[model samples]
Target: MTKQEFLRRYKDENLTIGAEYMMILDKISDAPLVLGCAYDQGVWKIYKTGERDGHYIIKEYASENEAFDFFYELVLSKHNRRNN
Candidate 1:
């Protein structure tokens, strides 16, 4: 999706434009699976590359430390994504 589309889609979700982020991932099938995060509007957004393209937000949080812990679990192959 184009930048405009991304913004339009997630705009109502409270994700601020140009938010700061950090990506930490493990390789799968020779490709770097993006198990990463971005902080916006005082919330931590966790994303991972998967069957769908784009930065798919798996979860959001108010605590940065909690977000990091979530990432740690994800990297260790412990966390599971649940869609609502």
Candidate 2:
């Protein structure tokens, strides 16, 4: 999806676009954002969103499962913040 669409869908949180990916910031305390991108290699790049050197990281993953796990971890972090 386009950055605008992503932002609109997750407007409650902060959103930013990078060179190759888009990220959705967390609404709850102490939770990192969710980062992802559509890739030319027929796979989606997903990671726990963070920045350095003014760029969002699409962390290198050995497999899709690892990337997806990070994504879920971010979600769990958010949920925990919401519940407690």
Candidate 3:
């Protein structure tokens, strides 16, 4: 997605992009947002941060787009439930 669109969609959060990685940080907690990207065993992967530690990962994904979509949907679902 375009940087402009990403910024518009996730305006509530903080985001930083690097040469090999994109880091999405939570605005309130300062925690890494969405998941993170990694290349493992000759393949690209994405992972979500675990609750225990910064290095801890809760889940992994094989496709970057699927990972991003899932994270966005999760956030939207949480928000909708909160508003209800």
Candidate 4:
């Protein structure tokens, strides 16, 4: 999914994108998790920042669509777990 699509789908979830539009964050948790993308040399790198082991990248993706899909599923899982 594109960033705009993700935003539209989760408009009520209060998600935030970084100033450079390189990352999206979920701030509902105390330790906000993030899905970020960066251009490293000639490659587009998509990664997730997690607190599980001292705020590091827990996963990486080669494409924005894949990254966004995982991010979307992650948010849904977190919401479901919290609500249950």
Candidate 5:
């Protein structure tokens, strides 16, 4: 889906525009790729890449929906597009 569409659909949920983030993953030749988001006291979160058993998660600094959207789009959408 387009970014605008995503924003519209999740607007009531308090989505934000132009979120910022950095991603870290295992760089070994055959290591599993994970998505990480730095939020809430600067903790590193690992997201499963579906090659293994794990959950798709959202890490946000604030309890509000906008904060969640910022982290989710910044970390999730970017990685997904690249991997695809």
Candidate 6:
């Protein structure tokens, strides 16, 4: 999915958008969870952000669609776990 499409679809979810990244925040602390993505150096990167350790790269893809697909699933999984 495109960034706009992902945002629209998860408009009700806990998300924060930045110039080069999108983050899914933790409901309790309003801090960013591990789930997020950023674009740099012609590559789309999926990453996990920590409260203390900083961000870590999970994967990289050549296209936004692939990166977003992985990101969307991560968000859905987190949401599902929270609901259940």
The candidate that achieves the highest TM-score relative to the unseen native structure: 6
What tens digits encode model 4's per-residue C-alpha lDDT throughout 1-84? Answer: 865666677677754343322343432122334555443444334455555532344456676677567767765665566556
> What is the number of backbone collisions in each predicted candidate, taken in the order shown?
0, 0, 1, 0, 0, 0
Candidate 6, superposed: residue stretches over 4 Å from native: 12-34
lDDT of 2 by residue, 1-84 (tens): 333444454455542233343443322111243354333244445444444433344554545555455554554455456556
TM-score, one value per model: 0.48, 0.37, 0.41, 0.54, 0.25, 0.72
Q: Sort every candidate by TM-score, greatest first.
A: 6, 4, 1, 3, 2, 5
Clashing pairs for model 3 are 24-33
> What is the C-alpha local distance difference test score of candidate 6?
0.66
lDDT of 2 at 47: 40
Q: How large an RMSD does model 4 have? A: 7.1
lDDT of 5 at 44: 37
The C-alpha lDDT values of all candidates are: 0.49, 0.43, 0.46, 0.52, 0.41, 0.66
- lDDT per residue for candidate 6 within 9-51, as digits (tens), equals 7776764343333364221122344466767678888777656
Residues 4-80, model 1: lDDT tens digits: 34335444543322212223422212123455666766787777664345556788878766766665555334322
C-alpha RMSD values across all candidates: 15.0, 9.6, 8.3, 7.1, 11.2, 7.0
Judging by TM-score, tell me the better candidate of 1 and 6.
6
- After aligning candidate 4 to the native by TM-score, how far in Å is the CA of 40 from where it should be? 6.1
lDDT of 5 by residue, 10-38 (tens): 55555332233223322211123444432
Candidate numbers, best lDDT first, in rank order: 6, 4, 1, 3, 2, 5
Error of 3 at 68 (Å): 0.5
Winner on lDDT (3 vs 6):
6
Residue pairs in clash, model 4: none
- Highest lDDT scorer: 6
